[model samples]
Target: MRIEKEYRIFEDIEEVRIFNATKKDFYKPTPKEFDVEDMPFQELLNNVSTEIHSFIPYENGKDFIIQRLGTFTLNKYNSKPKDAMGRRLSKISPLFFDILHEYFLEVYESHTPKKIRFVYYNGKKLTKLSTAKIVFDMDRIFVVTNNVDTATNRRVDADYRTFDEDKTNMMENFSQTGSYYKVHGKYVWSQGVYNIINRAKEDSDDFYNIVFDLVIPEDQHIVDKIFYLTNNETSQCGEVIRIRTANGVMKVIEVNIYSYFDDSGIIIRQGLINDITQRSDYGLSKPVDFLMDGFKNSKKLALLIEPLSKKQYEFSKGFYYMIEKDYGDYNHSRKIMKNIVEKDVVKNLNKLINGELDKIDEVLTFKVDGNSNNKKIVELYIERFNYNNEVHSLGFLTDVTEDIEKQDKLVASNEQKVVLIKEIHHRVKNNLQVLNSFLNLEKRAYKNDPDLIIEHMQTRLTSLALLHEKTYGTKDFVNINLKDYLVDHDMKTEGFMELPSQVEFETIVDEDLNLSIEVITPLLLIIDELTMNAIKHAFPDNTATDNKITKQITKLNEGDARLIIKDNGVGIPDSKSISKNLGCEIIKSLTSQLGGKISLIECEKGTAYELIFPIRMDHTIN
Candidate 1:
């Protein structure tokens, strides 16, 4: 079976009626009766309802219209005056007189009015009361404007009743500034005294019972008190507040309670926090004694340096600058000194200080200015500066100056001696050469003499000439190359010694050997005489002629040398035989001066003369 569903619409049909307690009947009272004093509240309400019901035009025998008019009628005694429609529903024409009536009724009954007549324009306009409504039950209560629903919502109708922009905005601001609400659910014109009292009672009760819930007013009061202190500028505003912490040290807090009012009347609150904590404790009363001591020491140092001349003082200042706290000032002073000081002096001082150059140890010989004595005294005082350590360089300067002067004089003397020695050697060599030339010339003049006699003279002349030549050419005239002397003398034999020259001469010599010229002269002559004798007599027969004569000049050591002359000539005829010859005796005497000895040998090679001696090549007579 199919079921059909029916929908029923239910509306609120609460019946509202008014009863007159004084008249004991429901009667339509004229608008004039609304002014009657001493009427009960219910009497006034019933008169207004009855008048509204009877006056309302009915259509088609319908009581709904009358009922609607009666329900909507505002009680004139308790409602503020309204417009034409509102006045007509009140049962009286003069609505202001109803205010008088309500006031008198309160006096006569010895009671406060339970309901109040308030002129609240239900419509939104500020001046015009377009619709008026009465508050049925209310007390003294706050009324605040609030945001209304827009026309799109079902609450508003086609008549376009809305709040004015300025009034609406004012209400919105007032509502936000403080808490408020109407006591009764009624517009301002219909509000009663009871509604206000009831509203006040409700708020007071809430505050008494649940005071913890009201945080806004209390917080605002605290904020106001803090701002009052900050705005007075009695102290440094926005300074962090510090207190002794649990750790027993002062710590700054971040709480900000200060506010500054700007020129445009805007208040800006700022945070009071800082990285550095301000000191609040006073431990010591007087300044530290140690700090005073330091100040006194600094002043003493400054005074001690002040006695010096500006330049000297600055020098001392530079020393102090190294240890000063502000190094920039010290560096600035140093730069000034560097720019003004002489460059050469600085360079010399730098060299001495850095140990790159040695300091002078004796006075320098600079000519003194404006001195009557004309003394050549040394000036040796040192200019002092510090490098690695403190040293007394004054002594070094004095000693070195004196030493340098002595060295210079000695060098000059040595140079003069060298010149004199060279000149002596040159002169002696020339004289000996002249003597050799003279001997040659003399020998030529005596052509009639025996060959042996002339040969002997020439050899002796050659020996003298060789000595002078060696000394003249030598690096040190005091020393001669012994090998050169021997070679020179042996070469001369071709001119002097006659042939079938049975003496075939040879020399073995030290290539790098040198000897004193004094020794060389005597040694050369000794070899010459011995070699001549060997050639003339050692080879008495042609048997010795086939052999050679050997002469050796050698350095036995650094300090000694030997000259050995030997030949295949016949052996010395006899030691006494050669000893009788003047040449042999002269050779022996010269050998003795050389601190040497000569030996004559009778070997198969013939006769040999070996001379061993000390060569004092570096000896100086000066």
Candidate 2:
């Protein structure tokens, strides 16, 4: 028989008092069995055990004061009393200190008992495996630490190595936004599966119950498949399914399952779940096929972009068609962006690409190279989303060239209507002024005869009304054809006035001359005044019977035009008397208003007045 030596593990317990009275508060050891100044407490603590240590957390949480140090801590850290006592824990192990700071805070604030297990290493070799228990009472803290058994230590080290390898494999093969789980027997979940599916460790234990409860009714077939795989020990299976979250949001996920047997001959199933809610598709399923069909049939170009990289990941066929390219390559989308005409649109697109903007809804214009070299207008809408823990942008570009052109035409039409309204208003205001001027003249000329003044007013108003009626009837409100206006004026005057039966009126006008309302208004008034004067005075009751009046308008040149009014009646009795007649004076004033000069012609049998005025180049039809 072999003789076996027994090993006893020692526990080190320490009590510390927190002193708040000092300027710099600190914790000090309160040894109940020994005097403060005698017996060398450090040596006593060191000789007790080689596997335990006790400490009091400082106010900062990251640093601690050593209340007692066992041989294990001393040997593993190679620490001395003076150097290690009341020192920052970061000075020894900054990474470990950071890891334990939260636990230190939790124990201190809760004032409750807590236990923590950790491994300590000396260089590359594992030196100690221990567990720490902390308690607080009566303004004091008691800490106890014990060394773990050799078997437990070895098992923990092996588990840590296996965990690291599994973690590496998972990261290499699966999405980071996914979670891994292991199930044993009927719906029994592993301890490592926490906060997945049901979001609570206790609730996640019954995997089948959680799956059935969370899965959408339409995706019940997926749950059935999972159940069958778990029961039949299937090698592997993957499926995309939808579930409703606790908050009433629908989520899409991809589940990959692998089945095996544990050492105890119990069936074990491993599952990898990836939340693919933001992805457009998983595989060539009905949903993906329908989505691709939608993209193909849509007139808008759909695309996906990586926000951080500003790179196009996927695009629909319409994108290539819009660019006039047979296929899409890496540089093709960039080429399309280069054709954007608006710099602000480019900046907004960059903002969407860089995750600076959440959404962009705007119309952008592009100068496209094509047969006609026409500009294409497109409505661009982009929205930001997350996929696999990274920001992405989904966007659509709709060709709105025809729609935009129609909108522009409508706007132009409205603007033209506004201009026409303003021109009409201006013409009405001018006609009113002319009527007011006529009223003043008639009041002065025929003040003694109210009826005669009213008659003159009516005649002048009639002429103005005729001009307006002609203008309002036609589409062209600003300019009037001189020939048409003169003919209409003659017909309208016949309805209002009665002349000698022997007298006849004839008009000869240039067919291509179109005059604006400004010129036509004053010119028609002058013609009315001159014709009335000719009918009333030149062809009097006792005068010659065979009388004729001729009104001729001719374009002399590009810059000037002539108007001649001749009547075959008695000439002015005396040339000096011409200034005395109000009609003659009015004609002179109106001729001046037209920026023209007037001269009386030496006719053989009639009194003739000739007027010449400047004509605008645009007034001519040709």
Candidate 3:
């Protein structure tokens, strides 16, 4: 007969494809070759001993076996010999038989699949199988993966996290520094002493300066003596020493060591060191008044770099507060450097740690999430210091978003105030100069006539005061509103100024036009002098027989504005006389100050005075 085998896998267990594959030579091919029901119980027991796996057996079930293949057998590899009680040895033990019986019962009762390497057929050979081996029609079962922290090494408890913020981390970071020699320590053959000590030195040799003022004795003999005394009980097992961090804070450490012969037959010592700086027995916990002295009140997260490991940093709580994060070390490293964006910053940070840079006090602006375009500025401050003999960089990062914004606003406000103050000063100076000129003119020409002098001074003072008012009254002091100023006052000079109501005064102002106080103040005063000159001298006798008079006003060009005051009474004298008059001299001086030019034109009606000046169109009114 041909043989075929298959493993049909399933949940819980696998199935055997062949229910009863027989190697027996039966009396009839389709009839029972083994007559279990017909055979006597004793004969079945005898058959079990003869061919152990020919019949199915169960625990405490010798009565229920196929009658002819009665007695139970055991798996030879796991079977135990009978003891001194005179019991005989069996191929299968009672306990395993019980297990087998229960397993078979479960299969028979529930039709569940079970993989069993049972002796197959009368040939009594074991065959591999799975729960799915049987050709049974059943619905497919769904399988799901379970997520949990599982350790394949069941008895091992170590997954060292050097940043657990507890004693476990402290122990791992400052673990015993040397290994037990296999021959000397009996069972500790895991790590060699030399390898352990060398790695310890590589990790910490640079940090051992003066070490708490209890420096390790340099003399070889003294060190040996101390070790021997410690082992012999003449000295304590540990020596207390201080170790300073690069940040300059000193911490206490306890060192213990044992000497032994290694596999190389060389004498070696293994050491265990403990940092006891914060322990209560060390008295560093502090008095009541100092208990909470240096604790931070700010919400910023703090992390310490000393005695930290890459794995610990990957799982750090401080990193959790950042907007971006990944679950592994490679991702952490990629983004930590990648997010910086500025290559120079990374270069300088390396230099800072290497003691090549003076300091790292800079604002690092980057996206909150590594890949985002939104940026934030953080003040990264790092300082280098030496502890023991090792160099370390201590860094502090602070978000300066609010602070920078407030600083910018304050600077803008102060700048505006300064401009306002300067404008006020300019206005004061202009009015004072106008007052000086008015007083000079009155004292020189109208001194003999008190009434005339007072009258002229009052009118001049009013104009000067009105100009000051216009400059101060509006919030914008840099530029004077020309349109408003034109109509602001009535030009009310009581004795010296009177124009016919029929003599219409008209003005044109560009919507976008204004003049700086520096230019406008002098120009306005000059306009006052010229207007009085035209009214007083140009129309001397009101002699025009016509019923109406008119004055022409105009603008000269795009940047230049013109003021023309013309009348119909009379014409001006010769240029020589006008230039020689004190009023003309004042007008000329004021024009010069205003960066303007004044012209007197002879017209058919009378005289026309023209004042042309530059105007600042930037500061405009609608």
Candidate 4:
């Protein structure tokens, strides 16, 4: 048999790094391939060790250091190790350690020994306690610090854990501050710290508190510096703060801090910063508050300059609220600002703000020159009020000087377009009228049987002409207010007979919904045809006329409308002439084109024809 040769990607020696050798292969090892599942567990352990080592940088291991010292390991589970115990050198599985162990591993080197310790407490003693092994993952260590309180009282004795009104209110305020000092020892963190401190106190452990003092740590003190430098102590971490000065203006300060670094290294801390003054009773005195207040009180507009009275200016800087409104309406913002300003003022300052009022809605730059920061802030809002237990929207104005200028240019262009549109409608209407005149001339030329021929032709021409009239009268050239125009036409027509003067013919339509000009034409012709037929046939002789009639035009929704013509008269007789009337035939045909349903009912009092049609009013603006 020929000698077999096995091919491998790496040299035999290199392949050995990945594959393990069997007992007999130590001298002349047989080739073996490595698979994902077959990879040595020791390799996985080494890789984890390398990752942990790389993550914990030299300068940012403060939190991790404190954590690892505090945590318990399988090798060192008892009290502090005075000497290096042989057990300390034993191997530890990553699973045996807690989340803090992995967290520490992510930040620190695997081979590095953990240093520092932290004991958590919920009371004067470390009772009912558990400990974590601070590994490279222990950057989230529970360290001992008293400068800022982080206690939650949820763990207090069950019987005494009932809801507390004052504490609840304080909790809310504390929440606003982002982090608050839990004055009482009822909080869990406080209990933890108290327990840890007492334990240390019992054992004379003064090393922890002595390391950190009342003063902020140098590395984690950026916030303290910004607040102290700006002297804006009103800022609280993790919350929105409003600062209002003596005047009625306001300033809003939002502070957020997500990281802290101490002697050992960097740590993560997340919280909001808010100014309590913004929420206090005197917020109206802030500067922004005053301006917003003035804007709201003014009829047309309002204008405000920066650097108002210190108190008012502070209020202005601190004021903050959300403005909401319906689609296409700007009034929501104005209303929100107005409500905030007016609610806090005793006297209206309209007189002083009168001249400036007209420009309130106008866009302008609000510049504060005293501070190094100088920029214009733009705002827009609308007027609103709550009436009859409901909120009603009023018009809104905006500081859109640039936007307004552009809009003005656009409007100018649109105006030119409007003129052209009007001209087109006018020309179309005139042409339709001229055609009507031509029909009249034709009638004169064809004098024989003129009544029958002219009537049919006139109805057709009028149907076309009605569209022009509707187009010219409507603000939107595409949609027509057919009901109003038709009712007007009925009033204007000279030959139409009238019912009791008090009886009214009305149209109930949704003003917001628009309808196409095409639909209106067929609808009008159908109405005219029915009305004329009814007038002529319903009361054949005027001497026998003792009936009332009224028409109702109602739109069901955006896509459909109904027309009802009811009268008190003799019902239709069972004759083909009644159904075969030319007008009736034309009505049915036209109704088909409109995608509508027609019903003719002979009620005991009279006859009623209800016409329903589908319509789409394209009113969405680009």
Highest lDDT against the true fold, candidate: 2
Candidate 2 deviant stretches above 4 angstroms: 1-331, 370-373, 388-392, 401-423, 448-452, 473-477, 542-546, 617-622
Best-matching candidate per TM-score: 2
Candidate 1 whole-model C-alpha lDDT, 0 to 1: 0.40
Error of 3 at 414 (Å): 3.1
Worst 10 residues of 2 by lDDT: 1-10
Q: Summarize candidate 3's per-residue lDDT along 1-622 as a digit string, tens digits.
A: 2232332121112222233443231111122222233323444444432332222333432312322221222222322212101121122133323334544454444556454422122122123211112111122111111111111212211221112223222223333222222111111211222222222222222111112223333433444454446445432345655444434444455666455443554333334445455562656521121111222333343333321223323122333344344434233333455567678887887776456885777777667667567665666665555421234334455656567878988997688677767767776776777777777776887678777556555656667677678776665656666766765543454334455333434455555556776666677677666666665565444544442233333456667887676666556657778788778888888888777778877677666677787764233222
CA RMSD of all predictions: 34.3, 17.9, 23.5, 27.5
Q: lDDT per prediction?
A: 0.40, 0.60, 0.45, 0.39
Return model 1's CA RMSD, one decimal. Answer: 34.3
Q: Rank the candidates by TM-score, best first.
A: 2, 3, 1, 4
Candidate 3, residue 399: the lDDT equals: 59
> Model 2: clashing residue pairs?
50-72
Per-residue CA lDDT of candidate 4, range 1-622, in tens?
0111121111110000112222222112112221112112434533342111112222343222111221122123443322211111111222122223433454354543332222333222221222122232233323221111122223322332233333333222322222212111121122222211122222211111211121123423643343333222322234233433223334343445333322343222222334344456645321122224444433333332221221222111122211222223332122222332232221222321332222222233332222224433335332223321222222233333456668889998798577758666665675467456545654665568676555546554555555565665554555566655665656543223443333333344455445665566566667766765665566554556455556777778767988788766565776456776556766886688567998886577667888888775332222
**Whose lDDT is higher: candidate 3's or candidate 4's?**
3
The candidates, ranked best first by lDDT, are 2, 3, 1, 4
Off by over 4 Å in 3: 1-348, 351-377, 381-406, 415-423, 472-478, 491-505, 538-559, 568-576, 616-622
Q: What lDDT tens digits, residue by residue, belong to model 1 across residues 1-622?
A: 1111111111011111111222212223443312212212534644442222222212211211111123233342333222222223224433323332333333234433222222222221111111112222121111111212121213222122122323222222211111111111111111111121112222122111111122234244543444345445422233333334222443332233333433553333322222122222434121122322333333112111211122322122222322333423443222322421245544654565556655522233322232334323333333333211222122211113345668898997798678768667665775477446535654565457656556667787777766655665453556576666676777777666674535466788888887766666666667767776666576667643366778877778887777767766546546777676656766777788678888765566566667888877334444
Per-residue lDDT of 1-622 in model 2, one digit per residue for the tens? 1111111111111111111222111122222321122123556655564334455666645455454555554544555545445445554544435555555666767886766544433232223345567666533344556664332211121221223334333222222234343332124332222222435444223322444457788999888777556545456778888877665656677777666545564335556565565563533211122333467755556543332343434456676666566653435344556778888988987787666888888888877653337677888887775532345455667788888889999998888777767777887887788778877886888789887666566677888888878886674644689998888778777776767667877999999887776677778888888888887778876545778888999989876889999898877889888767777777888888888888888988879988888665233211
After the best TM-score superposition of candidate 3, give how far the Cα of residue 106 lies from its true spot, in angstroms.
Answer: 50
